[model samples]
Target: MSKALQEDSKARVKVLGSLLHTADISNPMKPWDICAYLADRCLEEFFAQGDQEKELGIPVQMLNDREKVNRCTSQVGFIEFVITPLAEQMVIIFPTLSFLTRNLSLNVELWAELWKNSFDPPTEDYEKLMARVNKVVSRCRAAGPWEEEAPMRQSSAQSLLSGSESVVTEH
Candidate 1:
């Protein structure tokens, strides 16, 4: 893979790991077990906040095991969900947790900013919300099997966003 593609893949894994860590804490369950749970919760959260279509696209049904979660988004949209287990496992085996953690932190901060700016009441208090999320991430760190040192490539956000519309519409 080209250097840029390789770097992007590494970054995607790190971001995905961070997301799983958040889900694990929010639900306090094994990663596999949390898949449906996170999906449900995200649906509720996104819908309740008036961002269902904009943020989550649509309510896709749960996929059978071995089926990949579908995703799509346009230039004017946002999509959020978990990475696949295969991808998740790959990142967990990567050998640079510190780098991933740093990148995760920056991304989380950016997310918080977006959240703050998106709401009239500023929905969540960024610092407090992040602190709570961080607590879960810390637990994920202690749980071990950290995915570090893996080299991989990631699709562009634009590309990743493209396929989600079908998934969302199917629900």
Candidate 2:
């Protein structure tokens, strides 16, 4: 009788697995709009976790806590400590994958810029400024109804920086 094959445990297999895992978590390495979309999804998940933890009377984790978590700060921490380090090491391991680190670096700069200009409140009284920035970002990211059926196109970070939404036409 034939038996099922076991999973590969070779060194190369392990390295490839690690690279694949990094790629899965490398949304920040994508263009700015895609990163924003992914960040929105991540926040939704974190909020859900926080809600469940609160309902269960368990202590909420910082990232999962909607009230305590500042998205910009948390994202900076995540990219700097988590994504950048991993991508840098991955590039060393696989030189052809250096683009991963490059994109991560660019994204770090973008996030830092956004945080400094918009998300970072100057003082306790600056909450309104942050809210306004968030509203503008939300509006820019809003998708039209046809977006669901259309092939997604990646938008450059420059477009986001410029705060211009390009008109789309149905072909």
Error of model 2, residue 154, in angstroms: 14
Model 2, range 25-110, lDDT digits (tens) per residue? 98876756677678768877988999999999999987888877766656766775577666655666566665555555545555
TM-score of each model, in listed order: 0.28, 0.65
125: Cα error in model 1, Å = 5.1
Could you give candidate 1's per-residue lDDT for residues 1-171 as a string of tens digits?
236546798776766776576445432122212322344455455444544333566643443211232211110012112322222333355534334333332233333333343332234455565564464345344434445432221222222234321213321
Q: Where does candidate 1 stray beyond 4 Å?
A: 1-92, 120-128, 136-171
True-vs-predicted CA distance for residue 51, candidate 1, Å: 14
RMSD of each: 15.1, 12.5
Q: Lowest summed-lDDT stretch of 10 residues in model 2?
A: 143-152
